[model samples]
Target: MTMIGAQLRLLAWFVIPATLLSGCAPAIRLDEAATDRPIQTSSAPPAAREDAPAPHRPPSPTPTPVPRAFALNLYQEGDFVPQYTFDWCVAASIQIMHNVIDDTGGGTWADRVQQGQLWEMARARSSNSFNGANPLGWAKVLTEVGMGPYAVVSIADYGEALRTAARAIADTGRPVGLVMWRGRHVWVMSGFTSLGDPDQFPKFSVTGIRVQDPLYPYGDQQWGPSPAPNALLTPEQLATQFVVREPRRWSSNLPTGYMLVLPVAKA
Candidate 1:
């Protein structure tokens, strides 16, 4: 019985120590930052408070981007007549060669050549004949239009002219060339080709082909060499022949757009 009592006393001592140790455990504080203050409470004025002030959002709609006007250093000084880009630059060139021999208008080939009228008026006096009609007809039309034969076409490069026409007609927008394919002759380029890769330095380039074919007939009705020859004129050659021809006389200022007549024969 005494041993049993001793065992019971030992158990009580152990239980008392465990209870006292647990009572000495550290206290963990929660909700330390919590406060009873109302969410809206503030000392500053309503305007000065960050939450009270109204948000200054950017104005409703963004301004629209205005399109840049077409501009260039080259400008037309004389008078202007409408012209087509591709047909005149290409097909008309072909017709010009054909008309040279067909004698369609009783040796009036020169007249027909100048019939381009308002069309070829770009090159001051030089481009006039290429337009169509003879020098006399051109003069008559010039009088009628109140513009002299030496009128000026719009100040524009071949590329600009083509783009304007293409846009008007809903074209795919390819830079067209006045491809005058023939055997061997002086290449007269009046059109341009877009530089395929716009990222390149030169965004566009010129291509003027002279009308010469193996079958191309001279004034004597004699056949030339082979037909459909390679490009006869390089850009430099054309520049020397066409662009540099009396450069001081007329302004080569290329405008954003130009005018041209669709060559009737090619169409």
Candidate 2:
């Protein structure tokens, strides 16, 4: 074979084999720009969590204020009756009670006598002497007249008695019979005052009391000066006349202490 022909045959043999091998192999591609960028491995996007804590909120406002002090003066609306005789205080007090409660459809009794008759009836019922009427007798007479259903509360604590009397007066709008001076005399409880509002009486401390004193300035010398009718009396002043449990000189069966005639529901 000629030399040129032999050289061309050898080149064709090398070139054809290389082209066939390249066609059989897989192609590999690379980008220079891709190597410069940061690799992001995660598929999820950035977002706030649903369970995260909420922002702060302002506090709620306070409720309405309550009253701290109060006073109830029932004396101005009540009737005042003076006892004719020293021992007739209970009768006189009952007369006053009748006058006040009569308008409210209470005080239904055939024996609505002013003083003498009531005194007699109380004395007879209680088995009391002519000296004076006893608390039991007074309460019994009031109950018999339909003016009651009265309770004879004998209490040793003065403050408790005062509270009870005030509550009774406020609830019934009737005078409370106060057995004063260790059962030597009787007075009426008409009203009261408190450190807290009167409407919230159960929550307050009683500061003062309005009383109807039948004896007034002319009380027995041994019992101290009687306060004027419908007088506003301090606890200290009341303590002067009011005493703890003591036996009575007239009645032997009566219970001792600060006694009161509290009206209750009929039957």
Best by TM-score: 2
lDDT by residue (tens digit), candidate 2, 63-112: 76665766776564547778787778888877776665677555432243
Candidate 1 residue-wise lDDT, 150-191, digit = tens: 222332464543343223212221111221221112221222
TM-score quality measure for candidate 2: 0.69
For each of the candidates, give the backbone clash count. Answer: 26, 1
Among all windows of ten consecutive residues in candidate 2, which has the lowest summed lDDT? 105-114
- At residue 24, give the lDDT of candidate 2: 83
TM-score of each: 0.25, 0.69
Task: Estimate the overall C-alpha local distance difference test score of candidate 2.
Answer: 0.75
lDDT of 2 at 14: 100
lDDT of 2 at 55: 84
